[model samples]
Target chain A: MRATFMYGAGDVRVEEVPDPTIVQPTDALVRITLACVCGSDLHPYHSMPTGEEGTPMGHEFIGLVEELGSEVTGLKVGDLVISPFAFSDNTCEFCREGFHTACKHGGWYGAGGVGGAQAEMIRVPQASGTLVPIPGDVDEKLLPSLLALSDVYLTGYHAAHMGNVGPGKTVTVIGDGAVGLSAVLASKQMGADKIILMGRHVDRTGLGRRFGATDVVAERGDEGIAKVLELTGGEGSHVVLEAVGHMPAYEQAYGVVRPGGVISRVGVPQYEDAPVGFGSLFGKNVTLNGGPAPVRAYIEAAIPQVLSGEIDPGRVFDSETTLDDVAEAYRLMDSRTALKVLVRP
Target chain B: MRATFMYGAGDVRVEEVPDPTIVQPTDALVRITLACVCGSDLHPYHSMPTGEEGTPMGHEFIGLVEELGSEVTGLKVGDLVISPFAFSDNTCEFCREGFHTACKHGGWYGAGGVGGAQAEMIRVPQASGTLVPIPGDVDEKLLPSLLALSDVYLTGYHAAHMGNVGPGKTVTVIGDGAVGLSAVLASKQMGADKIILMGRHVDRTGLGRRFGATDVVAERGDEGIAKVLELTGGEGSHVVLEAVGHMPAYEQAYGVVRPGGVISRVGVPQYEDAPVGFGSLFGKNVTLNGGPAPVRAYIEAAIPQVLSGEIDPGRVFDSETTLDDVAEAYRLMDSRTALKVLVRP
Candidate 1:
């Protein structure tokens, strides 16, 4: 089975690996149908410490259940399914609260010795809880969008949900990456009156506009904040979504969120410390809430919209490739040549 | 007029100062009926950068309007009122959203040229917005409790409100100070099934119990977290209220909050930065929301309970003194000899 692996920084390869088998009573073997390179993947592709052995890559995929363990319930062999980026027991207190990412027995794909999603076949633990079954055979055209539900779309939805983006809200979305564009779609779906996308790129901002961004600010840093404030009648937006995980993005979010507003981040943060001090947030009465998206929890709520064609988040995939060309997918995404790259297995 | 002034670290004096008078059309001269030394005041009392000019102290008070400026509305001379720690215009976008502390035209007492509450008279700016009028003459016995609403009680309520403490939830309140004790009362009022008060002082914890702390964890830091986790059946509390505004208290809060739970802090955070990295909160899906309490917003909702004797938050005042002995009040509170001190003019 061909799988994607990262040997070191800037080095991605597709190599033949052994097919995954169910090792636990709660596990299932899933045959990958579609996988993609994510914005987060670029973190390691740009600069992750190299090891003697290559690390498995990719955490998002839509697949078919090739085999199910005896304990796996609510699923059958050959059923199309969406696997959340992380595997959870779903019965834990966190999972019950729709925070599957924090499930007591959960772990992320490609971490803790788990099989990666960019592969021919992968073993999924806690299958009953981690896998959301897709009804009927999925159309080839809808694969990329459905596969998005495995992570990015749900993550963007989580950002909007946490930021409290709703009817009549002025929402500012930072980053023009796939997740940011998805957040634009989500803010629109949530009924935000005005959606502002802050990005310097022309192409991505154009797509952001198509995804429901009412305005776009090409300025960065202080200028971006000034632009957002100007667009919001000098009061700043009611909600700010941070889809870029860095100090600058978060600082911009903190600056552009109106007093008493919220800033939600779905981007995996790169910094360790945030200055949530008296000078930054206290006087503003802002609420900061967002971590990993509860992708499993949002799958059901988001799937109908995708299936009904209310939104087409798959447009984020600007390029497509075969399993053997997984390295090209990573290269294209790494260099910003592709907004997102879909890989067929 | 006599007012409490901090000449240096640990040096408090009730000195003769010019009586406050209206300086703005929106100002009102308030004759304080009761003023209390706050836990936050101790921050500067312990050590503040001293100069030739003494710093006026005090931010909590219930008073009678002695004089109303020409522009003052909704308030009349001789009317008793509760003043939030900070004064706001109450018409700004932030105040409209119930965040008066963050009002664009507001500023904290004793900072930014605002009059201190411990004085015989205070010139309150934005009087119509800053003062919540007492319907009738407040009894002398009820003065302390009503004054509690000015800061501590409202602050505790803000913590509980931000933490989303409600029916059937387990609540853990850090600190045994007036605010923490108030949080216990607030949590009970909000219908929390179990309220845990984490404090070391038996006397304060006794007051916490009287205020409705179902459990008391006397341990601090890691042990305190362990005790809270143990009390919640190893799942941690659903809501952790941080009433202590220091690093350890925040760390303990982040430690004991259940996954997907909230940690609401109204402690006037002392630290400049907090580690909100993946290692701290990202994987847990926790939410952090809190700031200076919008006391003006909560006064209406909370005063009814205090007036009806449903809760006695003023019981936190374990000592009383005249304005002349303001230094003694600070001394007693500084050495932990008093839980709280009520000052009368």
Candidate 2:
């Protein structure tokens, strides 16, 4: 099977790899139909050290079941299904609470001897609890949005959900990537009264506004903070969605958040230490939350929106590629030439 | 009039000062009947530099409205009132959201030319919005509980409220101070099923247990974390109420919090930065929140409970001092000889 692999920083490759098998009774083999490059991939792309056999890449994907282990239930061969970025048994205490990302018996794809989703066939452990089979015949038009439910779209939803974004809220979304744009959409769906999208890219911010951003601020750092605050009537935003994991984005979150507001960082933090004392979060009485999306939790509710055409989350995919050209997909996302690059295997 | 002032580290004095009077239309003169030395006072007590006049030394107090400003409605002269640690107009967005600490026109009593509550009389700004009047003649026995609502008790309630403590949840409180014990009491009131009080002092932890702690762990650092994890069946507490502002207290919070849990820090954080990366809060998807208690918000809901004898939060005060003996109150708290010191002016 052909798969994506990273040998080191600035090195992404599509190479032939052995097909995955159902090694555990609760596992099943999945043939990925759709996958994508993520902004998080850029983190490793910028500095991952060279390693033996390289590393499997990609965690988001929609697929068809190719083979099922004897103990696997609620799934059959050839069934179209969606797999969350992280696989969980769905019954663990954490998973039961909708925090599947931190499930006691769950793990992410592409690590710990598991193959990444950007592959021809991948073995899925805890298959019964991990796979959400699409009902009836799947519509081709909903593919992108359904695929999005596996990660990106839900990641954005997680940011808004954790930030307590809802009616009468003034939200500020930092970053113009697919996840950030998705947050703008989610905030709209959640009935936020106003949303300020912050980005330097005019093209992406335009899409952000189209997706429900009431305002756009093409500024960075101090100016961006000032603009957001000014737009929010000098009190700053009720909820600040930090979709860019960089320190600057985090800083902007704190800077533009109203006292008693929330800062939800869905972007994986590239740095560890942050100010939480009087000079930052504590004095303002702000809440800092959001993490790995718990993508599994949002998938069920999002599927109907995609299937019914209530939302078009797949709009984030600005470019497409095949497994054979997966490297180009990474390149497009890395160079910011594409918002998100879809991979069809 | 006499007032308490801190000239420098380890120095406190009760000296003559001009009587307080309303300077603004929103100001009212309050005659201090009850005040207390708070744990936070220790922060400045240990490091505040010597100055010509010195800093006024208290915020919490139950008092009588000696004189009302022309604009101060909802309050009358001779009305018994409770003042939150911070004063706010209670009309700004932040105050409307119950975050009086961050009110746009609000300020603390001991700062900005305002005399502290540890005085014969103190001028309160935003009187109509700052003072919560007792409905009737206050019973002498309920005095302590009413005073507790001014800062300590509500501070604990803020931690529990922000942490989302509720039925069927496990809580871990990391401090044995008045605020921490108040947290234990508050957690129980919120219906937490398992309350783990983590403190080394037997006397204080004993009080915590009496308040509501179902379990007590005296271990500190890794040992404390291990004990808490063991008590939670290895998943850690659902809510970790951090009432000690030091880094170690913060570390213990993360160490003993279950994935997707909340760490509420009412403790005045002494450090400027902390680990917020995958190794700490982010990876586990833990929510970090809490700040100076919006004592004004909870006073209303808590008043009935105190009046009805449902809770006796005032039990936290272990020593008594008069205006002339205020310096000894500071010394007792500084040496940890008193859990909290009550002051009668």
Candidate 3:
């Protein structure tokens, strides 16, 4: 089997690796049909590694189950499914509370030293909880969007849900990548009255509009907040979805939400210390909520929408590359030329 | 009129001042029937004034409406009412959102150069919105508890509300002062299954138990959190109400709430910059909420309970003195000789 590994920053390679096998009664093995590079991958790709540990390179994927442990229920061999970014038992207290991403025994598929998804096959623990079976056979063309349901779509959905974006809400989405575009779609589905996408790319902005962004603000930071505030009649957006996992975007998200409104950021802060304003946040009574999306919880609803042609998040895949070209995919995504680069094995 | 003024730290004097008169169309003159010392009062009483201005001494009170401004409605002269610590026009966006304390035109009665409730006659702006009329003259015995509803009761209620305390939930209230004791009562009314009061005093602990505290832990900091976890079977409390405004108490509240639980605090942080652990907070998915209690919102329900004798929070008042003994009242409260002190003119 071949898998993608990061030798160091800006160095990604697909090489032969040991095949995955069920090591626990709760584990299942799946043959990967599709995988994609994530924006979060760029964080380490642009920075120094903590130590000399081999790091896996992908998390989001949809594949066919090849084998399952005897303990696994509700799933079997020859089944197509989507695995959420984080694996959990789904029966823990956190799982019951709808924070499966924070499941007590849950761990990230790739970032936690586990094998990455951009491989010929992958091992999924707690299979009954981590994998959601597809209703029917999914084609290769539907792979990008289905793979998206694994993380990006769920993250975007979480952003909208946490922000309480619904009917009559004016939502603002910061970051014009796959997650932001998915957020625009999710916000519309949640019945947001208006959605303004903040991005510099015309193509991405166009896709945002198609995905239900009623307006677009090309500026960043203070300028972007100014435009959003202006659009909202000086009140600012009622809900803000921050998909960019950086300090500037987080600050902008905080700045543009109306007092008493909500700011939901799915952006994974790169730094250990994320600076939050206690004074301003407390004074305005804003609700800040977001983290790893409970993708498994959202897959049931989002998959139906995608299969019904009600939403086509596949448009977010601006480019596609083979597993051998996984390194190029990383470069294209890091350069911001591609919102998301679908990887085919 | 005579008023209590804090000239500097440890310097409080009862001095003669002109009687307050209506200064704005929304202002009403209130003759203080009962004014009490607050925990926040100690901030200026023991430290330099925040601004270079005359320091008025109190904000909590039950008063008689002596005069109404031309624009005042829903209030009449001779009406006995409880005035919230902060005044706000109920029509503003913030007020409409049930955050009257953050209203655009809101004014703090005692802190920002406005006359304090400790004075014989105080001018209250936004009178109709800030004053809740009490039913026909209450007995003198119940005046202290009713006066507490003006600020302490509502503030404590806000904490419990922020924590989402309700049926089948367990709540831990930090601090055993008047506000913390009131929080126990509020949690019980909210139907919280269990209430734990953490403090180091026997007198207030007894009062808290009487006010519906299910358990008492006289430990401090980590030990207090450890006891709370022990009480909740190592899962931590479902809600934590931080009634004491300090870093240690805030940290303890954070430590004692289970993941996905809420931490509602009404203690105003005296420091300009308070650092919080975004790492632990974000990971736990805790809902941190709080601010000044929207007393006007709760007074409608709270006042009736106070009037009916279903709950007597007035037992928290261990000392009652005349206006001439205001200095001594402060002394007793500062020395922890009284849970709360009520001053009469």
**Model 3 TM-score (2 dp):** 0.94
Q: How does candidate 3 score on lDDT?
A: 0.83
Q: Between candidates 1 and 3, which one is better according to TM-score?
A: 1
Q: Which portions of model 3 miss their true places by more than 4 Å?
A: A111-113, A271-278, B49-53, B111-113, B271-278
Find the candidate with the highest TM-score and give its number: 2
**Displacement of the residue A5 alpha carbon in candidate 2, Å:** 1.1
lDDT of 3 at B31: 91
The models' CA-based lDDT, in order, is 0.89, 0.92, 0.83
Which candidate number maximizes lDDT? 2
Per lDDT, what order, best first?
2, 1, 3
After TM-score superposition, what is the CA distance of residue A301 in candidate 1 from its true location, in Å?
A: 1.7
Could you tell me which 10 consecutive residues in candidate 2 chain A have the lowest summed lDDT? A14-23
The sequence of per-residue lDDT tens digits that candidate 1 reaches over residues A75-184 is 99989999998899999878888888888899989977786888888899999999999887667788888998988888999999988889989999999999999999
lDDT string, candidate 2, A1-345, tens digits = 898899999888888878987788999999888998888989999999988778999988888999999999999999999999899999999999989988877998899999998888888989998999988897897898899898888999999999999999999999999999999999999999999999878889888988999999998999989898889889989999999888989999999999999999999998999988988899999999999989888888888888888888999998999988888888888888999999999
Q: How far in Å is the alpha carbon of A226 misplaced in model 1?
A: 1.6
